[model samples]
Target chain A: MSEIRRRDPRREWIARNRLHRDHVSVLAVLGQGNTPSEWLGPNGVMRRNPHAVGFIGPNGLKRIDRSGGQQGGPATVATGTAASDSRQAVTIEAPAFLVAVVPDMSGGRLSSHDRDLLGLARQLADADPARPGAVLAVLFGSHKEEALGEAGVDRLLHLGDDAYEGYAPEARLAVLAAVERDLAPRHWLLPDSPLGGADLGRRLAARLGERPATGVWQLEADAEARGKNGSGWRCTARGAANTRDFLRPLPRVALALAECAEPVSETRHAAEPVTLAQPLPVLLSRIADLGPVAVDPAGVALAEAGFILSAGNGVTDWEGFHHAAKLLGATQGASRVAVDDGHMPRHRQVGATGTWVTARVYVAVGISGAIQHLQGIQSCDKVVAINRDPGCDMIKRADLAVIGDAALVLQALVTLVEQEREEKRHAA
Target chain B: MRPDPQKSPSLAITVLVSVGCHPLTGRGRRADQDARGVELARALPLAEVRLLHAGVLDAGSDAALRGYLGMGFDALTLIEQPESSDVVPALAEVLADHPPTLVIAGTRAERGEASGLLPYLLAERLGWPLVAAVAEVEGVEGGVATLLQALPRGQRRRLQVRLPAILTVDSAAPAPRQSAFGPARRGQLAVHEVGEAVPDAELVEWVEQPARKRPKRLKIVKAASARDRFKAAAAKAEGGSGQVLDGVTPEQGAEAILKLLKEEGVLRR
Candidate 1:
């Protein structure tokens, strides 16, 4: 039988490799040498650099011994280091800056950073010109082409494995640690949307004992502003505080009240031409030197009506999911429950680690108001929460809280809305 | 009903609320938002209920969590996966040594890595039948335990699982019980350390944490008259005044509206 000739997905990879001929050094941790098209653009450009390298434990990898070599054969065994060129890990010098096209899940689709993420990336790129920039992105099985087209990226990394998707907290963190140790970029850039990326950044920052910031609309630095230690960089950014409420406020207090809301505007999506004078640094683990990932060349997934009837943990059962759906003419969404049950995709998650959405209305049912979850939906114009516990964190954050079971509250609300619609029909 | 000896033998049920987002680089979850898996975990009738806050822990938050841990469980276990967003390893650690007959968590974390992948992952890893979105877990009987599962459209289903199985309790399970101040204050938290070290990343600048927003109030309290009865009557009558102009030209209707507004002192002539 003739062996089937498999087409090399790396043909475009080789063409894309032509651009990186000038790059003298490249570092990849956990390099799998997988098909390049999955991680790169159709033309072979890399996208979604989601892996980094850090010091992993000694036993992190499987040990290999020489099979049946003679006395003088290659050393019987070799110790692998996190930075070793082994398939499991590798090490290299830190790049000038780390550029990640941080995944934004707002509107249930992949999006680029508003002015904030770009500003930070540009500022960091300008900070040091010698080292490469590392671009990291999260791909939700779709958006492969769009991710590769994101502006200001060098190498693209992909961190999607069937098992990794099912990762628990420890396995998830391990991958991050590995990514950190491999690509030691000076400056790390991420989008402000919820998804584990920015939180990982914060945790990574805390682990490294560095200060972190949020809601940074823009970033700037004086060329002369040096780090206190004279070895790092200094930068500043514009931050915002938005408030969300279900009720339209008295004009006087509305502005003050507005401080708690999440930003309602989603990231703009366009296939506009972006000029790249020079390649930005993109370092990722597993794949070597995949370059210049793009922003959502593909549009994101969003609801047309600009409304979300979101359920939180407060929703004790599917009954709540049903009730909330009826009251607002909303599509049923779970706070990971729907996704975990295989009803929805992880891309639809709304929280710090999932997608960030600011619809006109976000009705949170059975959800406790946590700061992280608030970060995702606070931009919505109005928010309502229902729970038996009036003091659940969500109650204080909600525009209105009906103190009852989510099911009961949703049923009552559905009836009220239905009656209103019926009366309007009759009057008409 | 008599309890089945094999079903309840040395079996301990524990609920683990998965908090924190799935780790993707670039964005963070909201500060005030979460899936409230903690409440779901508390609702389960188990030997212990643990809320795992895997998101970025701001400064001075340990005491707050410790306070909550003191409420009532045998121990409040803190699973720390420093600087990493992957939760599978932590779940692996827990199930490896202390495999509970039943394990429950939110579908996803509140902040990073909000993939809602833990329950499936745990079930697959443990090779257990995962009853997701479970509403109620009846006691062990005849070597099997019955669980009320929440189906779509507010429906429910019952399933019986053998002992030593994993079940993911969803928000559709039942109303999570309220945490009383007393139990919350007295519960003892036994902090368990996972063996992963956080890496050192560069620090740029500290952005001042923004304040969370509160709900808003109404702009106008429209009352036509001072008396409550009069106000109610006026409100009822306000919607009845518009006259239908079925055959009248739009121009004529506009002119009539303009004249009425002028007479009422609403518009200038």
Candidate 2:
């Protein structure tokens, strides 16, 4: 008897500890049939069985056998029905387009989050071949057209006015309402900025009488499906308790979350400049610009940082925390206990009630992970936890756990990093 | 520096409280928004405040409802409705009959179907301007109220909106004061029967399963080595083979960490 040996490339890939671009796609390739499959769970445990197949669930990857079939049946049924309904109900008249609302910063600069939205817009446009969509950017302040064009934007709708100087929600809403009417886009993408993106997105959704999906991290359009409603877009978002995937018809608005897509640098096409002819509604309220107040660089605003070193109640050495943060050039964060005990400021607290961070790497020291603290760092790419308790929440959720005192571990890390820097300096 | 009391009429504030429970524990308590709403009402001078709840009156909900009354309130209006009935229509009907200068609520409820959609839908139904994530009510003169809207990253925006508006309090609002036991036990739960009870259509079939942890970010390793394999195996273990520096000196522990850091490529030397 001949045996069909289909060796999964991911098994070897996982063994190497190399970075995979998309885990969901990997699961799709592996979890095809009744063949025995091996996969790593979110807790880093590997399970292998004949009945189990690698599946991408809301909470990440799971080895689902036939026994787990009943539990997942309802969620799939719900999404399928909704997708079919939305596809049939909405009719597309104008050319399919993905309009992104670009956020303008204090200076004549575009935020990384906004740039990511442009990249995503371009990706969505390229997905459909029948009527390849166009990507448009609604710019607020003055910006270089070349820079925006390079970030994969096909066209620029520049709104350079004195009213667009700061985070003016009302003025922005009026401008978006006018743009929506003029373009009548199939999908409206807004970057989930702390300044004004969320508010503007919700307000525009209400005005258009459309239900919006917020905190959307992943979106894909089903282009090859049958029926008019079958080819709608599917949006994945992180809800309060669980992650959810839903299908929405055309003319839907979504608030794009951070760290979902990388910004593209190469310009794919020439970006045409456009303008608005209609007058905007009068602003209801005026903002008083307070000059920039200086803040500590290593403070609690670590939401956008690529590297973060956070301390918990287990950390006793404040000096070590500061030293480690400086050595790694990472932002500083603290668990609720550390903030409550006066070891750190209230602004530096990371938890359910505090700031939600999406960093490339998060290093937790001396912090026993409370559920709230774990919730805040859900989007972190790599979590390296150093704690005394092996059974703590932080350790369980971390990709790497080093059992030791936080101060000692941080001190050692700082020392090694400093030595490396000094050796490089001498070589130079 | 106070405004003339005779010129400005006292503002009428109405607060909507919902049954609060711990999302994980399911244990009932006073909702966070209700407490903050009550506290905000207490801070306003020349304000007539009333507390209202629209839900079924049951033994399970009594404890949480009483918890709100414990905040020194003499009575709370409970609009009787079934568990499956829609509360928005009932609340809107009652508010229309007894219009107030301002309506306040928490950003969202903590219990079942906590969609955070009530405030937005209600505002649209009532044709009232909605202000969300308000930290404080700076002042109210004539018909305009100045509000301090809470933004992320420790930033605040001030805006003025016309009165007869709805405001949702964010976590930045002042914490509620302690609830007195005696006042809570003695407080009245007044029942009001108004509006039609419309049953909500249950669209999605809910299946119960043990909560699962979020999926780990997929890491693809390109380096192929015996040391890399060992490191990967160690990282994937449930009760990881982490070196516990129990009884070791801080210097020894530091050295072990330095070795690990270098092996992990977190530090280059």
Candidate 3:
């Protein structure tokens, strides 16, 4: 069976002949692989035997292309797509009560953190299907977010008035007060983020005299603490600079972390417009918004940097590193050695002993990552290393490692980035 | 009460400090934000800064409180409050008694519940304007404080909060200066006997355990058919061993890095 057998000429000719009526059946009679596969059934159907077609791969896994490419009938490529999404449009016309959510809406868009907060709102709202509670999203100021309904908001109370804009926590809190009086929401959920939710949420909780549960990461039904009405929910929240966890009863107001619960991906809600029954009261505010200050990204704190350009002892060309960081518009971070050498400020140090950074993209230029440095950047989504030594721990941890002189690599990168920017500008 | 606005009056700044717990090792330390608040207070020109704390002084808390005093303070006022009691009332009362020109504090403590509701609650109780997430207090002029408030992604908003305003220092604020050993050792902890302990009603009811690691979310492919699911399941886990570009020219390495930056959507046009 291992040897390549000479084909029978008569059968081959018959199978090749288009005019032959038995040609189709004869084709099937010609088995596929090293082993005989299948035969033509009496009803003119080809019975497939898959084991005969495929060979075991190097890792001892069976490899087979079920696209019918072996004996092509236009290859039954099953690139099947779902006709429609899994999302179901839901409307809670007469909700028993309301659960309010106030999103940060930074840059006039609902951030991922906002979406997660809304997800938590949905959980509390849809906890009991028998008497579903609607999620009322109080969106102050102007927001460009289009899919409020898709984000699991049942009622959208948008106050696009100029008064609700920037640094107007007083006016925003007034609107929230109106919400508390009118809707009397059962629960208020906000993101435990610094953008706006943390500030506004804390104010809302304080103004309402409700003790809030901040940094809540998870919620669970406590059977032992179940009330007469229904199952009472408890939560685990980060405490004391995130050193400890506090298990506390789910408060009327809950400031949750990102991914506390998954974002609403399975359902779309009716984003019905809501208005306060009574006109909003004008509260005299002592605080005034002077607009935003123009700050260099490099001067920003390492903990909040979305992208970081970090330097270490191996970075001999300090001037070039700074230039590259500026060109890249990244926050500056440094290793302990760099800081100790007076190259970078103490505040710019990145490590367990320094500031724990959660940068999305951390580029370590010439850094031999110490354990503390790695610990500080553990929350970073991706790390890119440009190092002279390939065996450095930073290189091992990096998703992409460029083993070369850090100075040269950074210089070349800056040039490429500039070129790309030029092309983009021209195209635009 | 605010000072008479006739002349260039000196400001009396009160900083509310708290015991902080280290994240890695659960030892007591000066809370980061609170330390920053102290630093912010100290930076204000012509302002006499006073540190206030509301917690029991003990072996564990002693180290934490001393951590605050080590920031070049001769002494810090301490109110003897219990471990699990609400400190808002005691702190609010103290503020009302003294009535400083401005109240500066961290948004939250680094110990206990750390709900970040202290300044807000104090402001509500005192009926004063509260500014949260403050990075820096620029200046005080004509009873108005010009401040820099921290926003997400390192953005800053300038605010003019009327004096007697409560400012909560943001984590993004300038990092606190090192606490010197001399100041820490010499600084005295003045113990003040305060009102009865009011237990945190809600916190006392719930159970607490050492935090279990939050499960990392897996990439869920919403496949329609079994074949797609099979394909997704059989796919190798990505980034197991990173792509190392060794022996490549700097240009090639840069090009690769640029590509990755583009793919990550981090490179701005």
Candidate 4:
């Protein structure tokens, strides 16, 4: 009953050759889909043939992926989804110039903002393929990201010293200044984020006496350009607190916003380790960092909160809701109805008119999901709705919707969390 | 508005304010972060808070400058400068003339280029330390001020910046007090004619435009294989693919929420 089907090398060669009379039948028997991309015609005129199977790209373009991602139809599609090793390895040896990028590296990962900045750097570096530049990433402290090469970094300058951690903008500024003096990079790109780059970028700009373009979100290769190095480029930056956009020529230094450019998706770089040619200058910093302060989640600002426990009109048991928020270490937020009913302060309201929160996880208990409320939380990664009404808008929007009494659910969650903590404590 | 020298402490705080434009109506108002900086300075005990601005006091910005005055200030020192001129030198000169123990400013302006570099340049020129994204001033001891710096995701860092240092307020700082119409109408803009203005050549050359709406990043199934795409599509559609559990008991609901919380790495335990 058991049979080992072995490979037929001669038949495979004939099917692949495409010149044999029995090629068609051999391919059919081998279950290998036909239609070669190109073959010599009968008269020796070459012909280009389109594949019968092709996938539509993200932009709705019919793209035939020759990386062996798609073939043999859906039946054999599950065989391999090797999208990992498809990146084209690119190395720019003796780059004409350098485009330096300083990523935030928050939580020791290349954040979306950092990736976008790298993408922008890639644009500048890859502008002229004949005289291509290299992207030099300036990393501070330590990082856990393993895909620095895939993130479009050509050169890596890591400062793993303990003195560069915490709020050491002064020391970080000194490193950037040294980089500027030694490498003389063509362009300096940094995320216009408050975490660290925004502070350090401004200091570097001041020290270099380069009027950097801050709050930059969009960039265009200009027709008529003028600059010392970053010429032929223009940028659009948000100004007046995002009320207007300032279109200006791209300068030597640029502090860009998140999503300024699409991250490098198709290529991998060397990410070769580099070093400062000179030693870092010791600074007599007047600001002394005392490390991080432990802040209660409840005291966290709504816009800055990573996880939010938000309540709504249906939240009857206010005491249980507050208890759950405190126990879960989640920031407290309220819907407009809850705020208007005086159950919560207006500042805590979550809606279009209220703070447009970018929390990673938004837990909406008893929220009906008003249009404005949904709009305000549009940027949140996950929405958890706990409501009795399954047909509510919040339930539809939630990644996980729990239909039940808000009070009872809160009580059960609190009890479950307490039990988990108690078990962990006992195990320790 | 000077307090009696014998009664008041010698702590001087100056908040640099800028005119803000409403995103929808384009109306002028007090810049959000500057107002927060002013609020932070005012919340500090026994500190003399002064509002400073360096831009043309036109009708549009006059109302905006007065908005800061409405926050219980008698006057705002407005150093007259042209539209395309660099204001850092003027603001730096004022700070150097009467160096304050602490200078507060917004992360960035709401008008013009709004590079958010004024404070750094001022600090560099004055040779003083500069702290960015400060949430609150805990207290001042001797000549150093202990400040709470706001980090991403609601975390904070404690720092001690020496006297005559500049601080830039983060958006996470405590909200500003509402401006009063009565004070806004009565408050005078103490306009000062400064020295010759140096036109910002780069700013004058570039064009200005309305903010363009960025395209939303679509969650495209970037699968390399047809099988992978088919599997991804079958697993979940764009929207309306969420799981809704009905007729579940409170304990069951709690279990589902806990599972999701754990999956998202939000549950600490």
Candidate 5:
């Protein structure tokens, strides 16, 4: 991966042979970003937030709800201070802008969860007012103004129109029409939601003549990082593959930078908002012109992801897996057997017929380290395994080994990460 | 293309039901247990869409016959089959006869074969696009019906295909809603006698095993008391502490122990 140099950043122009440089804007399909309250305590039990309405604490740790209504329950009742004066703002100066494909951010009867998500976006927007990005929230269905007004959208693109309801494919085509017209960004950002990213990514990639990678957390163009030689940022991602490719999960983070003199990360710009309403007429006229689509980007390249936490059968039990995953800010998954048992989705399954993942920090929890499973994840920069039996194959494969139950080790890890993060938050 | 402003096609989606066979208890099909079949029928923008409550059958064929009637299908056709080498052929027969626009089947039937092969085979035989793990069927348009395929990691994909397609639904599909017991009981089931009877294959041997359990093996035993947990940790510590070498070595060991304590959260700097 080429490094982004600040001194001589990539120029904004139509560089020769640069397919990516021509791209101009981005759209981020926003969803609820939540901080889970209860966790699996060290004792291998599900912990509830005591402040969470009626539930008991997760072991002994007192649940601190940011909203403060419940001590131990999952519901985050706001004390209201977090959003008391929040407003949407952006800080990037790129020719591009930020546009969020949001659900109904209008109307009066907003759900608490949507309210929190809006608050988060508002906070981020306010923190950086210099950026030109405007929030474009897509409402799910028909609703009156009273249903959306409070969610805090900079510019609302009401999708409740008859054509936009139903499947996102139609909505996407309309969105693309709008995108091509006003805010046609070179790249598009979508949440890795089960309901949205899977099909839309493939369809969009096909539409744009680009390959999309499903479940990508980060994306960038290579041109932003590499100099003139950069064509586009390589995308690193993991998804369900043939049984043969299931053992190893590809990197979950991807960067699709453009080819340019400067690195893409240096030019890393948040999504900006552009006018989508104007293109409706033209798109309506020419939609039939679109053809069959292509698949999302294949998980063939890992351009520049330094750290990753890959899980397999090793991370057993939903509770324990979630605990370890939260500690690392990592995506969670399972082995084929676990997926078969219905604990995790077959997509998150990692094994011979599952997703292939390789990262710098590869931690194997309870996975027995089968040859097929190992084959998929062996590309990781490092390997750490925790199992009750030291004689397991995973221990032999690991650069580090701890002989203990995966659940116990994960609990310890969660505590350590939380302690460190808490200290840092206080310090900040 | 603007959907015909005048008339939208009336599409009726039919879901076939089959029960898993018990060696002794026989076969029982739960057609009413199906909500997705109903949901898919509802998703169509047709004038009339109905759910077929196919009756319990000894084989996949038995269910298909009842499904044909319960769904208020335009016609009834029997799907003939030989000794059950597999139910794929029976399905093929029905699909060939009816040539229905949309055929939906459960990914797996709780049956003697219980193999989730019918949907895939049907797709291959019928040469229609098959979508598994479907959460929703958005709508059918211009000879193509749009479907919402649910992928792993909570991702959903939307697909559009012409009619005469087959979709096999997995458990991940939307949960079926409760049917009114009254209407379900009174629903008419017309059974068509299968004519193209294929000889049934003889079963050699059937091997059965217990269902697989989730792989969460790490068990953490909560201690009765915090002091007990501390004692257990102390007891579990393999190395004996405090070896005073009375010089440089002693200081190095002490520093190492303190570092370990700090790292483990037993001590905080």
Candidate 6:
């Protein structure tokens, strides 16, 4: 076999080096020498370094051992004068816990966001092999204790009261700030739910004077090896085109997105219930519960919907499109063209510049699946595209492609659904 | 609670404007932050609103800065600083010299080192209470302002914060009116010089790679039974199989979809 010549500069560089390209890129970008320094203390391990800045990497802070030998397994906290010096600056109360501020699940069930936070807490606890911390679930309202225990929460701090019924950011902030002051946890984790998590996280961070990484999807912590300076957390946030990783010292707060971390299996941990010493301070007085306002059924927010029936330019029969959506109990969504053409309201538009949806099932009716439109539905689990053109991007990306007139397909589906429901009722 | 009309005279609103860069195109445009910030400031009836921008003026940024000017503002105070310099210290200095009753800004700039850390860092520097995601300013009275904060899913919360606080506007804030060309052409861009230049700590190497489609996230399955677990694993491994359904009747296609939906558990019988 003849050796093939590569044209691309990046590929050629990788081929010449024969080393991990990411590691080489980090060294080249930071202008660091390629002498593998055994920098971690005995038992300390360097996971992976993407881009290096001084001691910081994509993973975490790296300690450079000038002695030059990769003899250590994973860096463990070495007892020495340097460690003592690092510890002298800050005093930490032992038995540090990973606290997750979780909201009351609407129906007493754990949301995926809740699960991600629990998983994050577990990871943070496991990071510190020396003194494995406990995962604390701070519940704003009453929840199923069994679910919390099964989610691997070691402790449950329940703040159940009539006043804490609905989502109140101010009240939650007061309680969380007080909890932080009382418990003094090493890490405070929150899901980046706009309902309250993002707001609460930012407010708590501001209150505690800690810089937080919001909408973080990946995070790693070194809680066990608390040098004089204490441990630090490395958070990775995904942007449109790039990924940005932030490294902040321990006693920090972060808001992780719902789907960021892989949730671990439910563990049966003995849940120890605790209460706040002081009552939650009343920051604001509620004037009245106005109840839910009436909104147009056709104009539903795309982001919150579990199932969406989206219409595009190809959708001419608005009545059929809406009827199908109603019959299937799916929220109506429109592409930019549909909204621009006044077929649907502006709020119903879903794309890059419009609402982003993470629905369980997204049915595209007549949507050509433009890049922007696809971007909006990227998080959708199962996509069923109905398009006239067989070669359209929508058909290629969909889990199920129905090559037919969108109106006919939608009408048929709606009729079939209605008939099935009627038959089931009669059979019962 | 309603804000008192009598105390409106003492209110002074300062809106901070920054260059918003488009992430994908890298084009300098009127930032969504400044647009919302400007609109929020304009909404206040009795308060005197001043527009401020911090950075050395360039052709790309001047155009974006003028966007605020186009929205009926006469002049924008540009605190001259290098693009690479940290604007926090300079911003704090200017803010200290001419302290306003309330400071409003966008949550974060869109382009170039969009850390979303400015509001938090600025609040820390000024030692002021920071309020995020403000949808509307309900009222300001007696050194306190009533704000309707935006929550996820169109819910709003009424919050009262003491004056001399910093607020970052969310997208839920009323959409800004289109900028008039005549006013934008006539608006003044006043520049102020600062003493020091803070060196930029370019920690993360930002390589502009072509945007790639995001990989599908693994669905978290919590099945207890072995059969259920096996089914879930198989579904994930297969990545979903589908038929093209070419030349098929609408009835047949609907049936196929219904079967798939039932298999995926998206629909109930």
Chain A of candidate 2 gets a TM-score of: 0.45
Q: How well does candidate 1 match the true structure in TM-score terms? A: 0.33
How far does residue B130 in candidate 1 sit from its true spot (Å)?
16
TM-score of each: 0.33, 0.56, 0.69, 0.73, 0.32, 0.58
Residue A272 in candidate 6, Cα distance off native in Å: 1.3
**Which pairs of residues collide in candidate 2?**
A17-B221, A18-B220, A18-B221, A18-B222, A19-B220, A20-B220, A59-B215, A60-B215, A87-A229, A88-A229
Query: In candidate 1, what are the lDDT values of residues B107-157, reduced to their tens digit?
Result: 434433233345555655665554445556656555467666543223345
The best candidate in terms of lDDT:
4
Better of 1 and 4 by DockQ: 4
TM-score: which is higher, 2 or 4? 4
Q: Which regions in candidate 1 have their CA more than 4 angstroms from the true location?
A: A1-98, A105-115, A128-140, A144-150, A154-184, A196-231, A234-428, B1-38, B45-47, B50-176, B180-269
Say which prediction, candidate 3 or candidate 4, comes out ahead on lDDT: 4
Q: Candidate 6's residue-wise lDDT over A308-350, tens digit each? A: 8899999989988877777676788989999998888898889
Top TM-score prediction, candidate number:
4
Query: What does TM-score give for chain A of every model?
Result: 0.34, 0.45, 0.59, 0.67, 0.31, 0.49
Question: What is the per-residue lDDT of model 5 for residues A101-190, given as tens digits with 9 covering 90 to 100?
Answer: 333222223333344334433433343355544444545556544523344545455545556544435455557545645655433433
Which order, best to worst by DockQ? 4, 3, 6, 2, 5, 1
For all candidates, state DockQ relative to the true structure: 0.01, 0.06, 0.39, 0.45, 0.02, 0.12
Error of 3 at B40 (Å): 1.2
Clashing residue pairs, backbone N/CA/C < 3 A, model 4? A240-B110, A240-B111, A241-B110
Off by over 4 Å in 3: A1-82, A228-231, A301-428, B1-8, B182-186, B230-269
Return the top candidate by DockQ. Answer: 4
Model 3 residue B136 CA deviation (Å) reads 1.5
- Model 6 deviation from the true structure expressed as Cα RMSD, one decimal place: 19.4
**Model 5 CAPRI quality:** incorrect
Candidate number that wins on lDDT, 3 or 5:
3
User: Which regions of candidate 4 deviate over 4 angstroms?
Assistant: A1-84, A226-230, A294-296, A299-304, A308-325, A332-428, B178-188, B218-269
